[model samples]
Target: MSSSCPTNPSSSTTRPHTYNRKQKSLGLLCTKLGVERRRIYDIVNVLESIGVLARKAKNQYTWKGYAAIPGALHELKEEALREKLEGSQGVNAKVWDDEDDDETLSNSGSQNDKSIPNSDAPKSHKNDNRREKSLALLTQNFVKLFICSNMELISLDDAAKLLLGDAHSSSIMRTKVRRLYDIANVLSSMNLIEKTHTADTRKPAFRWLGLNENQSSNVINSRKRAFGTDISNIDFKRNKVGVFVNGEFSQKPMKQKELEHVSGLGQVDKSNLKHCTKQSSRSYQFGPFAPASVHKVGPSENNSVKQVHDWDSLATVHRPHYQNEALKELFSHYMEAWKSWYSEVAEKKPLHIL
Candidate 1:
């Protein structure tokens, strides 16, 4: 991402599959990965791009797992070399620009710069018309920039320029960088790449970490997550929430992303959402049959009774003081729930709290 970045060389760690390969449906993956179906495409594109997943049918993909990445990177490096070779021979081919956005960075990784050729950028001008801006293609090409060269770090701006080929329109470059940010986020989560800064200018850049096979267990584990990460979002409405993990559909994706920030109380914990009174309310009108226990009051009288039960004032008065933040938030929510219920019930019947 332009705001932060990715980093460092990790030798293609050769390892075994983390788990048994199980074919998963889109809905099932949505449930497992803690993301909506629409957002699933980003994961699909990144995994399919890197050879970790293969589409067996519509809305389903076979999990190739990490075993496929080495082969995929090898193929990409070989393909880039082939393209570079063809370009040298005056044959037209798609090329990755490999040029740095800053000269200081250009000088730092000079050897890597020489290993890749930007001379072919001009020649690949024709491909823009024929080429579609596929995330998978951009992903492969972006990976090619790292795998094909020994460049220690490259910024998203630089990466976008390289992948953009001859299309340097401001709009196109902006779109390319935005997509690159999403790819970087997912890849970083997988540990395939890391975010860092350039050594020279200290500009934000990415270093390819590749596959880390050196862990005690070299397989992908889905159960673990970083602390303080919340994926649940309260704003976006999901159509069909099919299945859930830990008794709820996770608010955020399995992989935490900086782009999707699900911060604050209500976003992660929606259980107390019933306490939110955002809807407009007309004054309650009591019918003649309104229970003998409940006195029939006019709209104005009801309004006066409702005003008497000020939720915030009442809640604040009863709210407990706590030194611990967590306990404080818990009590705060409890007060809010009590307040909402008290206000709603005060309209129909008086409550006597012991």
Candidate 2:
């Protein structure tokens, strides 16, 4: 006996519509169902798979009986339901419930059959798929959290504990770890998250460098390919009085006087930061390249020409004030870049699992 029952459309012609039918748009469907728009679309796809509703030329789904067309399970609803009893009595309500489903199936055959896919599958399979999708969402949220926090170096254990709901549940913890690694691998492959050894013995670490830098050294350090290294070992040496010029500043060198004016470096170290030297009165001489450029002129003119040191090539001025300026600039760049990098990363889809 088929589980489908035909709706007698002609007989119901005079009957008034019963259920409150409110037209629902896609956005409203998502909100009401508590599912993402994409998930709603997927559900629609699955419904189409079983043929519960017909899709019109405009690609919209109409209610099951709107077309009055018989589908695969049309005869199921007409099947007679049987009463069955077990040990304690002549008839059991529980047992009747099971038989009633069969009765319903037979009576509303096509409609029930079309809707059957949602209930016919094993519970475990459904749960497994649901958990998988949930894990993906968790990972995405974690990544977003990390970026928003602007944390440069973060541990996997911390990330896992923060994301996995039951901190004590080993199974949940393990699942989160696996998902994190999966996401990490995907980001690494895309060159978004760089994986490198931070230390000689420790495991590799991931770095987010989608940010700008100040002394340029900050940017270089951010790009440091070696991960898991001791933060103490990276020789963060400053060769000169680093300037934290704005990104809009020209790349060209500033004269000694100009450097003092902009950097507010006192006259004591001004000579060391010269941009160029004057030879005799007409030509400019650049030192650091003194020996090479001095050869381009006669002995007299070469001797007369003075080195005009530029800001870039200024002699090492590790004055406490300048060092402080450089450090402040470096720190600012680090924080800004980190925040920007993290935000950009979080906005993307989770890499680890689909």
Per-prediction backbone clash count: 12, 53
lDDT of each: 0.39, 0.27
* Cand. 1 Cα-lDDT: 0.39
lDDT of model 1 at residue 338? 32
Best by lDDT: 1
lDDT of 1 by residue, 1-354 (tens): 011112211122121221111112234433433334555566566766765555434332333333345445555555555445434342222233323221111112112221224442553334322223556667766776665554546678877765554446788788889888878766654456656665545556676656432321211222222110111221211221111111122233322234222111111111111111011101111121111111211111122222223224313332222222222222223323333433433333222111
Clashes of 1: 12
Please give me the total number of clashing residue pairs in predicted model 2: 53
User: What is the alpha-carbon lDDT of model 2 when measured against the actual structure?
Assistant: 0.27
Q: CA lDDT of 241 in candidate 2?
A: 20
